[model samples]
Target: MSRAEVKQLIGVKDVARIVLGWGAFAALLILHPLLEPPVPAPVLVIALAVIVAVILVCAFGVVTQAEALAHRLGDPYGSLVLTLSIVLIEVILISAVMLGPGEHATIARDSVMAVAMIILNLVIGLALLLGGMRHRGMAHNRTGTSAYLSMLVVLVALAFGLPALIGVDGSYATAQEIPIIILTLVLYAFFLFRQMGAQAGDFTEVDTRSPQRSPREERTGIRQVLAAHRAEVIVRLALLVVTVIPIVLLSHDMAALLDDGLGRLGAPVALAGVLIAGIVFLPESITAVRAALGGEVQRVVNLCHGALVSTVGLTIPAVLVIGIATGQTVVLAESPANLLMLGVTLLLSVTTFAAKRVTAMHGAAHLVTFAIYVVVLFS
Candidate 1:
């Protein structure tokens, strides 16, 4: 395709990824000589980190563009796009590692657990704690919160809990997984229908107290704003896909580097999972935190719980299919220790949200659970 034709397809936001993709390519050229040499641990770490930083920049661009689109699209759809973009990143990252030569049977499981831990315990906790400190207790819809919590609890139990209680084929059975995968997708679709379709005015509703638009935005007019959002969505969506291809392409190298690096350091084998989890979770972490601080705990819940549900709801099916097609083993259960923490964290989260208001102390409790997760990760 001619640059002119391609140029017509992209907007200002797409320029960010275009510029970054080129910069990353140039950086790789510069690093060719360095990467060719016998790579040292520190040197390899630096090299990998640089590459990761570039990928992260692309991801952040996607998040920014998606955030704008969310503002324009409105909740349910907007929130769906926001969380799905982050979820897509997580999926891409994990799929890359899983499909690589690394023998990480549990990467999918660990990554899901990590995302849930980070969002529920860390992000949710911080949002509530900080917001509560300022507002004491912000009123939310108890029934709505409870509905989301109910689905989440059932899904988590089915995905993580039942997997632990049952095993087959020396690992997670393809037969078993395929049904769960289908059920997961079907159930999640039904949940979305309930949330966005039937129950739109109830639990899944957006905050009526939406912040006012800027004077500039007000003058832009609905048609103009939608046109801009549409253009941006098209351009950035393409760019986001283009940007992620490289991240996936480079996953083999990243997998090798991480495997060797972590192995050499005598670190926990799970550190590789943590690295991917941390990288993928970075954008949502910022958004979730911001939602909390803005007295938008519902937004925070939507982002956090939406992420958690998407992780288990969507990722399991995708990962299972990949694992089965590639003839690779897949593991889905957490350690007993992690399972305990996850159960308690889920329990605490639902309990806290049962009230029409959440307090800072509730946030602190979740953070404590997060701390415990970290300690378990290393120990």
Candidate 2:
């Protein structure tokens, strides 16, 4: 009955809701692969429904974690982690599927393009647009934004555009691609280290003016916080790993089934791309949507812009190397529709950010652009 007890009850209730939601989602995800049609047909439908539910739940968990993790790890890499996690999942799935010898090099190209187009058109575009609408020109350090965007352009151009323009013949041994791949990866690694380690401040909007604390001060502070919290960071990370592994397995199964199902159903092939994007982007998409609803444009800007940069700059290069090495070729060469989509995405992003600020009108404009993309894909 006491006030402290009352507050504790409310806190526990909120935590319960989150845990239950995620737990239910995890359950469905776990059950998805086990629900093969050797079982009754009606039962299979029920299982698919559960799979859908789990996807929604997992999406919720992703967005919730994004806010919390971003606070802890700092933007934009904190946000980068969300998108990166999804991209990593996709790469793992594609790599697994492409383990065979007959896989096309263009598989890598198509996937990269698919992911890029989805991220650019829907995830990044609308997040920024809606966030801009809410904030009416949310402020991000223009310098950092420009740098991130520029690097993204160059990386995508090199990875996707170059391959297309050159019309690389299958006759060229993948061994020839290895050196270029290594050089690109090494360059990326160098930039990553510099960005995260010594120059982390260069990417931030917040200016931390406090003098550097001693190692002891930092350690003591960390110790106190860890001591105060019952759950450790390691525990959360382990849970994330545990939860992620099953989801990844289930995602692979679902990807194969969905591909078959959509093809049999006479669904547009782009639906396959959309489904892939849905699984990979569930986390980032939910965050942007929630931020839009909440009228938090700055968070939206950080999520969308950061996701775009990470998808193209990091994901594309990583996959290019993986595809070449694994002989899967998940790059952008498979689908011309995907190439057109990527071009539209790049054009929209360049124009959207060219002003260095965004408005609600811009958000509406981007939504219209996204509508066109969907129409074109389905048509």
Work out the TM-score per prediction.
0.79, 0.74
TM-score of candidate 2 against the unseen true structure: 0.74
- Point out the worst 10-residue segment of candidate 1 by lDDT: 214-223
> For model 1, how does the per-residue alpha-carbon lDDT over 1-379 read when each residue is reduced to its tens digit?
4567557656666677757756676667676677754468789878788778776776666566556655676554556666776676667667867787869787777778877788888888888999999889877756657777887888877767787777653256777878888888998888877666545434333355785444344334434755756665565556655654544444434555676777777778776766666555666666667666777777777777887888888788878889889998888877789889889988998889887789999999999999888788789
Clashes of 2: 11
Which residue pairs come into collision in candidate 1? none
For model 2, the stretches where C-alpha displacement exceeds 4 angstroms are 1-45, 100-104, 169-176, 205-231, 292-302, 312-331, 334-337
lDDT of the structure predicted as candidate 1: 0.71
Candidate 2 lDDT by residue in tens digits, 1-379: 4567545433443344356555755665676566553545466556556656655655555455556656665554555566566656666666655665565545555556555666566665566566666667754455555656666676666666666665364222365456656656676666666555554444555333656444354445545655654243333333343344444444445554566566666777766766666566666777866766565544555566556555555555555566666655444543465556666666766676667566666666666766676777677
Question: Could you say which candidate leads in TM-score?
Answer: 1
Provide the overall lDDT of each model, using Cα atoms, as 2-decimal numbers. 0.71, 0.57
